[model samples]
Target: MQQCYGSIIRRQQHLIRCLSTKMQSFSMSGLEVDAVSVLRSLAPALDPNKHKGQAGKIAVLGGCREYTGAPYFTAISALKIGADLSHVICTKDAAPVIKSYSPELIVHPLLEESYNVRDEDKQSISTRVLAEVDKWLERFDCLVIGPGLGRDPFLLDCVSEIMKHARRSNVPMVIDGDGLFLVTNCLELVSGYPLAVLTPNINEYKRLVQKVLNCDVNDQDGPQQLLSLANSIGGVTILRKGHSDYISDGKEVKSVSIYGSPRRCGGQGDILSGSVAVFLAWARQLASKGEHNTNPAMLGCIAGSALMRKAASVAFEDKKRSTLTTDIIECLGRSLEDICPVH
Candidate 1:
């Protein structure tokens, strides 16, 4: 009985700390949002009666010969974040390797790179790829674009078509890594889609600013610039990842400056993309049911940024200098549980 009382005290203390963090974040930037509260509200309770794919079905449209880990990371992260189903659509060379990483993923080796396809076969192959993706596109609650996607012109062309189809079907997408690269060149792919979320790091954000704003990244006017960028792209939400993630959906700008690990490990962005996808799907469902009136994409980005930062902080507490991306990922469940307990 005493131990149980102690556990209750500890939990209460943790809750207080979480609230304090939110207050602190709010003070930092007037635009800072309460990420912990957002996370709790967006994360649905686990229901025993929920059927497969009811919670969420996430598909990652990335992976190529030179890159497989990114897609695997994104797909698995979706599963780890409580998505009912996770799929990876990658090149044949990447499919086997991504499959080797985890059996939890449904790997589809349908994408073809330039070297593997002849000039004469491009049109037919592109059509086939789109048709194959079309079969599974509507079923997914969200699609995470980019990750390990190589910047192969041929592969990107196929993915562009896939994006178009996904848009037609009204599927939300979290674009990151190489996916941002593709969108940077062709802004129209996700330009007006409010359901689309772009997670861009320093370099990716720079390119996007240059392309869309026709100028450089101004630190002094960061928030306004982000607002303009999102507005210029037709109000698609943009999550500018950095020390403090700045999110904008054109209407307003919100910042998530939650504490995170200092270790700059690779693949963390992939986790963010996957996390955002899952949360975006949940938020969208809630919106559809009239549970919340806020923009799902904005809520998704806020929750995802908070969760990823908290997870990284937890992993760093344990591993410190040795903390890797996988370590941060392993802490995701615990971090989320702390913020929004399953019970």
Candidate 2:
């Protein structure tokens, strides 16, 4: 492991040098990482000999009767990025809708809302839900929390239990949307877990700052505040989504300022969460084999952010004002090809 990390550190230095020499003669905010290089290094080579589930198995833990598109967007995003399987665990009413969205996804209608369950059954239902999730827990490479996850009290409690189990099992998670809501209230859930990644947008970022740091979001020294935020949570990665997505794992801050679209679509963050899950999986797989030894969480954020931005740009050029989140997702393959083409 030491030798592997040594080689990776040297390679990272080389990439940084290249970023300075090859790119334009202008200074960029934060450390401008060579995101394309990182993506290429992490993405596995295609091999016909590899069987099913060798690539990745991703699960999205969100979706309710009121909202099903969020989970569908996330799960399909993983499949489009070359994951082997995509599973969505949602409420009973949400399962059929999410399944109807795509036959490719494995929909489990197992979660319960407050209106559907009695107080006497909350404990047993929560236990049963956790059990069902546990049966397939170790099989997944990553779990994306809070896509269409509503703010129901009982449902949130069950999801909290699921998060705890995932932590115990050492499964990585990308928390977004309402998952941030759950984590904001209970920081201990991801306080020291290195594998937990928080993808907080503008509003979510504000709430985290207030709750975790006891201060407001400081735009004047954005990277510094971001560093403090991540460190405050004990080094879990934070991918602060914005015009220039800034990533920090409590040590250093890296920014990917690639121009995306002006259209701020709703499901774009879902796409990013799914993308990060796959890239993080690939990075960790390599690390397990002593291939590369940096923080997979940060690499995953950088690569995922870069790819999503590129795809958004392409989609905007093609569709202009009509560019939606779905359009951006449709361009994921082409954007990746633009970065690192297959031979």
Give the alpha-carbon lDDT of every model.
Answer: 0.94, 0.92
lDDT of 1 by residue, 1-343 (tens): 9999999999999999999888765656698899999999999888888888899999999999999989988898899989999999999989999999998999999999999999999999999988999999999999999999999999999999999999999999999999999999999999999999999999999999999999999997799999999999999999999989999999999999887878998999999999999999999999999999999999999999999999999999999999988998899899989999988
- Displacement of residue 9 (Cα, Å) in model 2 is 48
Candidate 1 weakest lDDT stretch, 10 residues = 20-29
TM-score of 2: 0.92
- Give the distance in Å from residue 125's predicted Cα in candidate 1 to where it truly belongs: 1.0
Q: Pick the candidate with the highest lDDT.
A: 1
**Candidate 2 residue spans exceeding 4 A from truth:** 1-30
lDDT of 2 by residue, 127-236 (tens): 99989999999899999999999999999998998999999998999999999999999999999999999999999999999999998989978988999999999999
- List RMSD in Å for every model shown: 10.0, 10.5
TM-scores for every predicted model: 0.92, 0.92
Candidate 2 local Cα displacement, residue 242, angstroms: 0.4
Question: Model 2 Cα displacement at 255 (Å)?
Answer: 0.4
